[model samples]
Target chain A: MNFQPYRSPSTGRPVRAVLFDTFGTVVDWRTGVAREVAAFAAAHGHTLDADAFADHWRALYQPAMDAIRSGQRGFTKLDTLHRENLDAALRHHGINPDQFSRETLEELNKSWHRLPPWPDSVEGLAAIRRHYIVGPLSNGNTSLLLDMARDAGLPWDVIIGSDMTGTYKPLPQAYLRTAEFLDLEPGEVMLAAAHNSDLQAAREAGLATAFVARPTEHGPGQAVDLAPEGDWNLVASSIPGLADRLGA
Target chain B: MNFQPYRSPSTGRPVRAVLFDTFGTVVDWRTGVAREVAAFAAAHGHTLDADAFADHWRALYQPAMDAIRSGQRGFTKLDTLHRENLDAALRHHGINPDQFSRETLEELNKSWHRLPPWPDSVEGLAAIRRHYIVGPLSNGNTSLLLDMARDAGLPWDVIIGSDMTGTYKPLPQAYLRTAEFLDLEPGEVMLAAAHNSDLQAAREAGLATAFVARPTEHGPGQAVDLAPEGDWNLVASSIPGLADRLGA
Candidate 1:
C-alpha cells in the first residue's frame, strides 16, 4: 500500500479528509431510482416508462436547487425539493397525483434514500476511510444522507452536506462551510466527485479536487462528464481506482 | 431477546434514535482531564493538583454556556469556550501565561478531544447501534466529538452537538433543533443521559428520556444524580443494561 500523503495541486498541502459527491459518484441513483419506479408502477397496475420517469425526475434536480441558490425561493431541504419535483413529473407524465396515496407518494419520494451504492462504492469508501475521514459532500439533506448511509452500509466518519450550509453545490459556501464544520482549511479537504462541473466548482472554492468518471451516471446515453475536463488533482475510472491512486 | 419496542411515557411513541449526553454519560471526562493535566504539568516541571484543576475548569462550563443561553454573549463553539476558560484557569492557578508556549497550551486544550470512554461505552454503543440509531447529543463542538469518536472508537451513526444548534443543553432549542435535524419527532428520540437535569429538560421538550446511572461521573465523591430522580421511560445501571431494557 502507498503510505505517501496525497498532495493538493494548488496549495501543495496533504489532503486531510475526502468528501464525496453522493448522487452519481458514490451511489448508482439512476439504476436504483428506475428500478424502484418500475417496481412501484408494476405493483400499482400502471404501465409507464419507468426509466423515462426517473430521468425526468432527476432532470428537475438542478432547476429546483437553482431557484434556492439564486434566492428566488426560500431555503428548503432537498427532500422537499424531491417531493415537489416528483409531483410535477407525475403530472407531466399524465399520471394523476390522486392515483397514489400519501403513504405511497412518501415511499416513492424516499427513492433517494434507498439508492444502492455503486459496485465499488462500499469497498472503496472503506479503503479510503482507513486513511482519511470520509463522508458525503452533496446537496442532499442531512436526513436523506443519514438514511442512505444506513441503507448502503457506507462507513462515514462525518456527514457534510448542503443542508448544513443552506445552499447547493457550485456555491462557495457549501464547500467552505463543510471545511469550517470539520475544522479544516478548504485546501486540506478534497472533493472527490464523478462530475467535472462539481470538481470545477470545488476547485474554484479553493478545495482540492478528484474526478472519478461515471460514464453512465445519466444512463446509457449520458454524454457529458464522461472524462475529466480539467486538471483535477486526481482522476480515476472508479472509486476503488481513486482509492488505489491515493494508496488507501 | 425481548424484541419489544420501547415506548415513550408521555407520547407513547416507539423510540427511533438514542442520543447520548456524551461528556459524563458515555465518557469519563473528569478522570481523562485529570490524567492529561497531571502529565502536562509534570512534563512542564510544575506541581499541581490535577483533579482540582479539572474540577475548576469544568465548573466554568455552565456559566460560559449560560452567557450564551441568556443572550449575554453571542454563540460560540465549545472548543472556543474551553480555550477561554483554560486561559482563565491558568492565571487562577498561578501559572505564568508566558511559561507555556502557544503550541503547548493548544495541545493541552485538546485534552478534551482525547477523553476515554467508559468501560462499557464502546461495547454498549455498538450493541445498541445494531438495533437503533445511536449518536452523541453533546454540547461539545462537532470537531471535538469527531476527534473523541476517532480516538476512542465510539461507533456513532451521526454527530449531533451544540455546534449544530449554536446553543447548549437544557435549552429547549437545543433539544428541539436536534430532533428537527434528525427528521424525527421529539418523542421518537430518547435522550440517554446520566444526569437528571438533562433528562428532565429533554422530557419537558417532548422527547423520551432514559436514565443510566453514572454514580462516579463527577469522581469519587459525586453526590447528585446517583439514582433516577423522575419517572423516566427507561432506567438502567449501564448502557448495555439500557439496551437490554429497550430490547435492543
Candidate 2:
C-alpha cells in the first residue's frame, strides 16, 4: 500500500483535517447526470443523449462563471447556469421551452443537488474521520452542498463552500478563508481531490495537497488530466487508499 | 407520538431548520466545567470550587460581551474571554501565575474546546436531523462551535455562529442575520433552545420557536428556568421529544 509518512511543505504541523472538493472528485457528476437525465427524459416520452447533454452543460460551466467573475454578466448561481445550458440543449434537440414550464426547468436544474457519490467515498470518508476532520471544501454553494450531503449520507464534520467566502477555489483567498474559518493556519489544512489544478492552487497557498485519480471524470473521450502533474504531498488511486496512507 | 403541526405566525412556511443557542442549550456547561476544574485542582494540588468558579465565569460572560457590544471593549473571542476568567479565578484561588508556565495556563483555558454534550444531545440531534437542518446559532464563533461539534459528536447539517454576522443574539439583528445567511425567510426557520429567553428573542424576531426544557442545567438551587415561560410553538421535555413533535 506504500504507507509512507508525508510532511507539509510550509508548516511542521501533522495534517489535522482533509478538505475535499465535491463534484468530479468525491461525487461522480458525469455518470450521475447521465443516468438521471436519461430517466428524466424517458419519463417525458423521449430518450435524450444524456452523456452528450451532460458534457454540453459542463462545458458551459466554466465560461459562464468566467462571465460572472469578469463582470461581463450579472452574478448568477450554478443552478441558473445549468438551466441556461439545459434550455440550449433542448432547443438544439428541437424541443420547445413551452414543453417544460420554468418551474420544471428549475427542478431539473436541481439535478446538481442529487449527484451520486463515488463508490469509495462514504466508507472511505468514515475511515478518514477516525483520524482527521473530514468535510467538503467545495465550490458548489452552501444549500446545494447541504442538500447533497443529506441525500447522499455524507457524514461531514463541517461544510465549507464558496458561498461562505463569496469566492471560488484556485483563488488563493478562497483556500485561506476556509482555514481561517476553521481557526487553523492554512498549512495545517490539506486539500484532497482528484484534480491536479486544485492541488497546484492549494500547494501555492501553503496547504498540503493529496491527489486521487479519477480519469473518467471528463468523460470517455477525455485526453488530458490523466494523472497528477505536480509534486503533491500524497497521491492515491482511491479514497480508501488515501485513508490507508494516513493510517486511518 | 402526536405530531400536531403549528403554523408559523408570520409565513406559515414549514420550519426547515432549527438554530440553537449552543453553550447551555446543547451542552451541559456547568457539569462540563465542574469536571475540568476538579481535574485541574486535583492535578495541581489545591481544593478549588469548580462549580462556584463556573458560576462566576458565566456571570462575568455577558457583562464582558455587553461591554464589547456597548463599545467598552473591542472584539474578543470566547477563548480570550475564558482566558481572562481563568486568570481571575486563579487569583481568587491563590494560585501564583508564575508557578505555571504560560503554556500550562493556555492549556487550561483550552479546556473549553472539550465540553461535555448533554445526555440527549447526540441521539436527539440525530433524530431531528432526519427532518431538518440542525446546527448551533450561538454567540460563540464558528470555530468554537465547530470544535465542540467534533469533540461532542453533534450532528449538524450547517453551522451559523455569531462570527458570520459579527453580532450576538438577544439583538433582533442576530436572528435576522441568520435567516439572511440561510436564504430562508424568518418564519421558515425556528430557534430551538433550552432557554426560554432565547426562544422569546427569536419569536420576537419573527422566527418560529421551540423550547426544550433542561431543568438540571444550572445544577442544585437552579430554580428559575425549569420550564417554558412564554407561548412557544412547541415545548418538549428534551431534544428527542421536540423531534417527535416535529415529525422526525
Candidate 3:
C-alpha cells in the first residue's frame, strides 16, 4: 500500500478529501432513471421513450438550479425540484399527470435516490477512500444522497448535498462551502467530475479538478462532455482509472 | 437480518436516522485524552496528573458551548473552543502557555479527533447502520467528527457536526437543524447519547431519544449519567445493547 499523500496539481499540496459529481460521474443516472421510468410506464399502461423521458427530466435540472443560483427562488431540495420536473416531463410525453397518485409520483421522483452506480464507481471510491476522505459533491439533497448510497453500495465517508450547502453545482459556493464544511482549503479538496463545466466552476472556486468521462451518460450519441474541454488537473476514462491515476 | 422498521417512541413513526453524541458516548474521551496528555507531559518533563488534566479540559466543554447556546458568542467550531480551553487548562496546571509551540498545541487539540471508541461502538454502529442511517450529531465540528470516524472505524452514513448546524448541542436549532438536513421529521430521527441533558434537549426538539450508560466516563465515582435520567425511548448499558433493542 502506498502511504504517500495524493498531491493536488492546483496547490502542489496533499489532497485530503476527494469529492465527486454523482449523477454521471459516479452513477449511471441515465440508465438507472430510464430503467425506473420504463417500469413506471409499464405499470401505468403507457408506452413512450423512457430514455427520452429520463433525458427530459434531466434537461430541466440546470434551469431549476439556475433559478436558485440567480436568486429568483429560495434554496429548495433537489427532491422537490425533481418532483416538479417530473410533472413537466409527463406533460411533455403527453401523459396525464392526474392519473398518478401522490405516492406513485413520489416513488418515481425518488428514482434519483436509487440510481445504479457506474461499474467502476464503487471500487474506485473504495480505493480512494483508503487514501483520502471520499464522498459525493453533488446537487442531490442529503436524504437523496443517503438513500442512493445505501442502495448503490457507495462507501462514502461523508455526504455533501445541495441542501446542506443551500446551492447547486456550477455555483461557486457549491464547491467552496463543501470545502469549508470539511475544514479544508479549496485547493486541498479535489472535485472528481465528468462534466467540463462543473470542473471549470470548481476550478474557479479554487478547488482541484479531475475530469472522469462518462461517454454514454446521455446515451450513444451524447455530444457534450465527451472530452476534457478545460485543463483539469486530471482526466480519465473511468472512475477506477482516475483512482489509478491518483495512485489510490 | 431483521427487515422490520424501527419505530420512534416519540411519534410511533418509523425512525430513519440514528445520530449519536461523540465524546463520552461513542468514544472514551477521558481515557483517550489522558493517554495523549500523559504522553505529552512525559515528553515535556512534566509530572501532572493526566486524567485530572483531561477532566479539567472536558469540564470547560459545556460552558464553552453554553456561550454559543446563549448567543453570547457567534457560531464557532469546537476545535477553536477546544484550543481556547487548552490554554486555560494549561494555565490552571501552572504550566507556561508559551512553552508549547503552535504545532504542539495543534496536535494536542487533535487528540479529540483520534479518540478510541468504546468497545461496543464500532460493531454496534455497524449493526445499527445496516438498518438505519447512523452518524455523529455532536458539538464537534465536521472535520473533527470525520477524523474521529476514520480513526475509530465508526461506520456512519452521515455526519452532523456542530459547525454544520452552526450551533452547539442543547440549542433547539442544534437538534432541529440536523433533522432538517436529513429531510427527516424530528420524530423520524433518534438521538442516542450518554448525557441526559442531550437526550432531554433532543426530546424537547421532538426527536426520539436513547440513553447508553457510560458510568466510568468520568472515571470511578462517576455519579452523573449512571442511569437514565429522563423518559428516554430506550435505555441500555452499552451501544450493543441499544442495537439489540433496536433489533439491528
Best by lDDT: 3
DockQ, per-model, please? Answer: 0.74, 0.64, 0.88
Let me know the TM-score candidate 3 reaches against the reference structure.
Answer: 0.98
**What is the C-alpha RMSD, rounded to one decimal, of candidate 3?**
1.3
Which candidate leads in DockQ? 3
Tens digit of per-residue lDDT, candidate 1, span A1-248: 66776888696888889999999999999899999989988998888888899999999999999999999998899999999899998888888878889999999999999999989999999999888888899999888999999999999888865667778988899999888888889999999999888999999999999999999988889989998999999999988898998878
Query: Candidate 2, clashing residue pairs?
Result: none
Candidate 1 lDDT, B138-240, residue by residue in tens: 9998889988998899999888668777789999999998888889999999999999999999999999999999999888999999999999989998999
TM-score of 1: 0.97
lDDT of 2 by residue, A86-131 (tens): 8887777666767887887777788888999889999989988877
Candidate 3 or 1, higher DockQ: 3
Candidate 3: the clashing residue pairs are none
lDDT (CA) per prediction: 0.90, 0.80, 0.91
TM-score of each: 0.97, 0.90, 0.98
- Per-residue alpha-carbon lDDT of candidate 3 for residues B1-248, written as tens digits (9 for 90 to 100): 54887787567889888999989999999999999999998999998999999999999988988888888999889999999999999999998878889999999999999999999999899989888899999989989999999999999999878887888778889999999989889999999999999999999999999999999999997989899989899999988898998888
